[model samples]
Target: MLAIAEYVVRGALSGAIYALLAVPMSLMFVTVRTIDFAVGAYALIAAAVCWSVGGALGLAAGLGAAMACAAFMAIIFLALKRLGCEDHIIYALASFGLATALASLVLWWWGTQAFVRDAFSDPWSVGGIRLAPQGVINFALILLLVGALHLLIQHTSLGRMMRAAAANQTGAALASIPVQGIQVGTYLAGGLLGGLAGLLVLYSAGLDFTAPLGLTLSGFGAAIIFGIGSPLRGFFGGLAMGIAQALAAGYASAMVAGMVPFLFVLLVLTTSRFGEEALAGGRP
Candidate 1:
């Protein structure tokens, strides 16, 4: 019983991180109708740059570096759009190229290795249960950010405009919404969220060159399960997916645990429920 509770806490911590990582993709897809296959690479580069900058300056400075990386990503997305091409799959392919280039850049600069963040601190223990302080902090911060983003989307005129643009770009243009600026914002938001996740991952785990791609896949799976294509359900959708993964890892065998996320997604697709209630996170 106590073991179950302990594992639950652990799951929540990790699940929150995954949720945070998933939000940007969800928001962007919901708002812009574009997919970024390289979302994970954007994060990887952010982590590397953060580590590099943090090494020289401080945590704040490292964050700046991550933001700068995201800013660069913003440029790439817009540049491609301006080139008269914005197909989801096509843009995602270009993102792949950037991912490869980023990976190479990381190898050139940092080599294939991990980093250590001293202030990240150790996990805290209570009532015979252990918890990571950094993990808790990350979780809380994400909640705040996600909540704010959701509120902004749901309540603000800008959010309405975004939804309008996402649904019908041409119609929205006829309606006089700045479709291009909104698109850029969507990509920028995606990049920033991904970059932040990358930095958090580094703080949580050591860095590796190939890890970003894997993390991107992980985030992508969770987003799909959560119906990220629809904004209203994104938060709990991502949360539920993260929690499902957490539970699988905690209770199942290593191999099965490794397969749980993907397997669950496949299961979701098999059922009609996934197609229905997309507004609530399930997808069609």
Candidate 2:
């Protein structure tokens, strides 16, 4: 049916945005073996800064905020390393607290007001389907960036060093790889991706203090479903999540739609061994 086609298209667009947001988290997890619970806050603060300043200046401000947030996370990670803490749960606890604190700070600074910015104000029509220009731009730009990042990781010397460090920090150090530097670089790269996603989210939806958590959840779920080991899979997972959520909203209820992403994740976890193996970064 035409309705089904429409849902699929719209969902895919939204899903692409989610994929972008998820990529940073996935990148961190896969490369650094770290989870930045504050990934969403980076996006929120960037968007807020962009809206407050407006124009190109606002965009720069937004990105800067994201970088700053990433720096803060990197500092935390560095501190943990200094203390000889390599346990992931410890990092998770620290990241959770960091996320909460950063979110609170953003709220204190920006207040709870939602911002609506004009983005891709044009709509493109294709064979009776209406699509927002911003949405298309979001999808295209994100994929391009993701692809570039992928190439950097797959083909570059720095990327190989990072991957080597990720696979075994001690071994990497023994192999003459700069493990500490690689860790810092990974965190910074993750932050950059997070900031970029935030800018895109601002264009897609009005920026809000609470936007980060939802974005984080969507991205986290997508990454988990697709296997954090494979960034490409994370992108596809987000697309699938978006399509399912769209269908749920169109055919069921808005509340149900909101729950659809997690439900789909649950379904994947229960029925698909691939999801688990992928989470573990093993071949499916």
Candidate 3:
């Protein structure tokens, strides 16, 4: 039971980090029906900067640097939007190009070496279970993000507009909602969150150039399971997924690590669908 609790905590922390990366895609998909692939790209780039700056500035400064990166992604993506092409495939390809360019730039600036951010020398632990202060910080950020998102969606006119826009862009336009602005704003927010997730990972596990995209894929898997295709569903769903993942990893056969999460994701998706189908059949 003690070991189980530790694994659960570990999963939740890691999940929150990757799930943060997942939310932007879910939110963007809700509104624009497509992902800004640049989310992970910009995050990876920002993390590299964070590592470079870790020598003099520290974690807080590193996060600011990460946010700046997202801001740059927003500006460039919007500028591209002004050129008048929103084709899904085109947008994805363009985002890929942007991500590739940014990664290259980071490589040139930061020499592809890995960085491990040791925030706490004495992590809190109990009975063979260890907890990082940074993990608490990660959980807090996730909660704050969820609270803010909930407040925005429920209390603001702009929030209403965005919800409407997500449901139907044409209708939203007819209702005078600025869909383009919403889209760009989503991109900006998503990029910021993505960068933060990357920073958290650096704070915990360190990073390599090849690691960013892989992390993004992990987040993507979580997003799919968390029902991140919708922002509102993102918060709770991501939490569940993170917890599930941690458990799988804790007891998983050491020889089969790479397959564990994938199997878990497949299981979750299958179960969700099966449950829904059973519910539908029982509705009679």
Candidate 4:
């Protein structure tokens, strides 16, 4: 039982980064009715840049690279819209292309070296369970960001406009709300959040060039686990995913541990209302 508790704690902490990744996914889905497959790429590039640069300047450079990538995605999105491409699948495919391109770029520039960094040399003991300070920091930071996002979405006038845009883009436009601008803003926010997640991962478990697609899928799975309606659900979903993966790793084979997240995604897609609605394109 104690062991189980420890795993849960560790998983929750690690899941914080996943939650950070999920926030952008949820935001993009709600605001633009599309998925940004390049989100994970944003994370990967950030981590790579941070690993190369190091220190405070690296952090800034990492974030800048991520947001710049997202800006490119925004430009593509606008171009698609101008070309009368209203299909959500097209947006997803476009982002997937961008993700692939970014991954290739990373591979070419950084080679196959894994991006990782250690913030602490020793583990901290808490309540009979050992924890990494970096993991705890990731969890705390995610909570702070999520809280701020909730307030931004629920309390502020800008939040109201975002909600209005999400609920009905035409109506929001009729009200003179800048719907496209809001979506562009959401993409930029995704870049910031995704880049942050990458940095956290760099200091925690780290990742490589091949990680972007998997990260994107993990975030998408987390977002839809409870519902993609809000970032709070994404947060919980990320924790659930992390716990499940940790438990799988504890008692199950490495293969099973890896399969845990994809399994959750499959379960949700097959048995949930969100899946049904998604298949039917009801949201759009």
Model 4, stretches more than 4 Å misplaced? 253-255, 268-284
Clashing pairs in 4: none
The predicted structure with the larger lDDT, 2 or 4, is 4
On lDDT, the stronger of 3 and 4 is: 4
**TM-scores for every candidate against the unseen true structure:** 0.87, 0.94, 0.84, 0.93
lDDT of 2: 0.80
User: Which stretches of candidate 3 lie above 4 Å from their native place?
Assistant: 55-84, 126-128, 273-284
Which lDDT tens digits does candidate 1 get at residues 1-284? 88777766776667665676677777767666656666677677777777777654545554555456556666777787778776776766776777777778778888978755655456688788877677778778887888888788878999888888878889999999998788777777777787777777777765678876776766766666646664334455555666667778789998789787677777775564643444354222
RMSD of each: 2.9, 1.7, 4.2, 2.1
Error of 1 at 51 (Å): 1.7
Candidate 3 per-residue lDDT over residues 232-264, each given as its tens digit: 455555666677767766777777765777777
Off by over 4 Å in 2: none
lDDT of each: 0.69, 0.80, 0.69, 0.88
Candidate 1 regions with alpha-carbon error over 4 angstroms = 55-61, 120-122, 230-232, 275-284
Winning model by lDDT: 4
Output the worst ten-in-a-row residue range by lDDT, candidate 2: 275-284
